[model samples]
Target: MNPGSEVVVTLRRATAPDARPAADVWLRSFAAALPTVVSPRSADEVRDYFRDVVVPLREIWVADAGDDGGGVVGLMVINGDELSQLYLEPDWRGRGLGDRFVELAKERSPVGLELWTFQVNKPAHRFYERHGFVAVEFTDGSGNEEREPDVRYVWEPKP
Candidate 1:
């Protein structure tokens, strides 16, 4: 059986009530997947970042698990043409939800979209590559919080 078969995810604009849950998903997924690539933050710190900063500053869309499970299973933060962040609950990985979010980002920014991921994050490289993103630049560990080498990817719609 397909992992995504039982779970139906629906995307929705995030509300105030979604801040905590969405932050929880982000914290857990980041802790599990990006220990070497991203800097660590306390759960409270992440919650505050979401509630006080991200929720107010960015256009965030959440992929909520429908009747199958419950609660937000994924999140995408889009700031203009940049997909600033995208994360899914560990349990929700390997489903089509990430692909859906990328499609939505493309739809939202038809001209192009750009994102950055740690160079060490091979899975992310593959995922973005499969979604039509191409690596455009590489940066040493100078600009980001984690101080890890990173790669920038951009997606342009086929004309």
Candidate 2:
């Protein structure tokens, strides 16, 4: 295997230890992807945020690679029948790792799934729609009263 040429991204269940690294990658990518996106707390704050939000969730998964160059490249946080978080590093966005991550999460989901996104995030809204998700509800983000209006989307995997 040649080094420094390509990344080998793979999907696996996220672990407690993965929370910090995942949060780091997620914070950087999310802020970059959505500049208007509310910035994350300081690094210390983000550490606890990930631990609380992602560490205890059994349904979440992380995209990692064996290369030392490879790390937690992407992540998804699903709960009950909803996918609450889906993010990938900006550099890794077009290679379809995100799609594969979605497919894997769907496979594990016994029932249909739902997610929320700000309507202003048109790219995400379109991606979910193109992947067969339907808008099911309107909501707010993390209790932010001033946030752009948001919509909930649901996807039913082929049985």
Candidate 3:
């Protein structure tokens, strides 16, 4: 379904216990969103990362495309002031879920916000740019030596 024209996504606040399952979805959605191949994390590490990092900052949203068969199509992981992850299944991209998700996140974040996009993810870079996020910095080798550089974007919320 189209993001702006045809999807009815449901959103909810998640708890600490949700981090593992959510991160599981996050990793899968990440592979779906990007070309990178990644293995799933051990169950325990998933739980720990969620508890220590994902859950505490507390501005997260999970979405499902109306039908249960759609499974969880999206996951957004946010920190106190910045968005850490906003991933969706490929089928669900371009419908504007990413933009709406960030808006929801900005409502909860008390400070100006920022996000990092890999240089290779040109479509995503365009999506962020279209939504009024401006590139503030660039990093070398996509946060590592194997990939392209990372582009950082900043968003100053409207009053």
User: Quick one: ranking by TM-score, best first?
Assistant: 1, 2, 3
Indicate whether candidate 1 or candidate 2 has the larger TM-score: 1
Q: Give the TM-score of each candidate.
A: 0.92, 0.84, 0.73
- Candidates 1 and 3 compared: the better one by lDDT is 1
Error of 1 at 147 (Å): 0.8
Regions more than 4 Å wrong, model 1: 1-5, 38-40, 66-68
Worst 10 residues of 3 by lDDT: 34-43
Q: Report lDDT (CA) for all predictions.
A: 0.90, 0.79, 0.72
Error (Å) of candidate 1 at residue 96 is 0.2
Q: List the residue pairs that clash in candidate 2.
A: none
Please report how far candidate 1 places residue 67 from its true position, in Å.
6.7
45-159 per-residue lDDT for model 1 (tens digits): 8899999989888999999886457689899999999999999999889988899999999989999999999998899999999999999999996988878899999999999
**What would the per-residue lDDT of candidate 2 be over residues 16-98, giving only the tens digit for each residue?**
88988888887877687677766536767877878886667447788897656468888888887878889887877878987
Q: Model 2 residue 19 lDDT?
A: 89
Model 3 agreement with the true structure over 64-159: per-residue lDDT tens digits: 665543746678877767787887766777777777787787777746779887877888888888877899998885465345578899988667
Model 2 / residue 62 / CA error / Å: 0.6
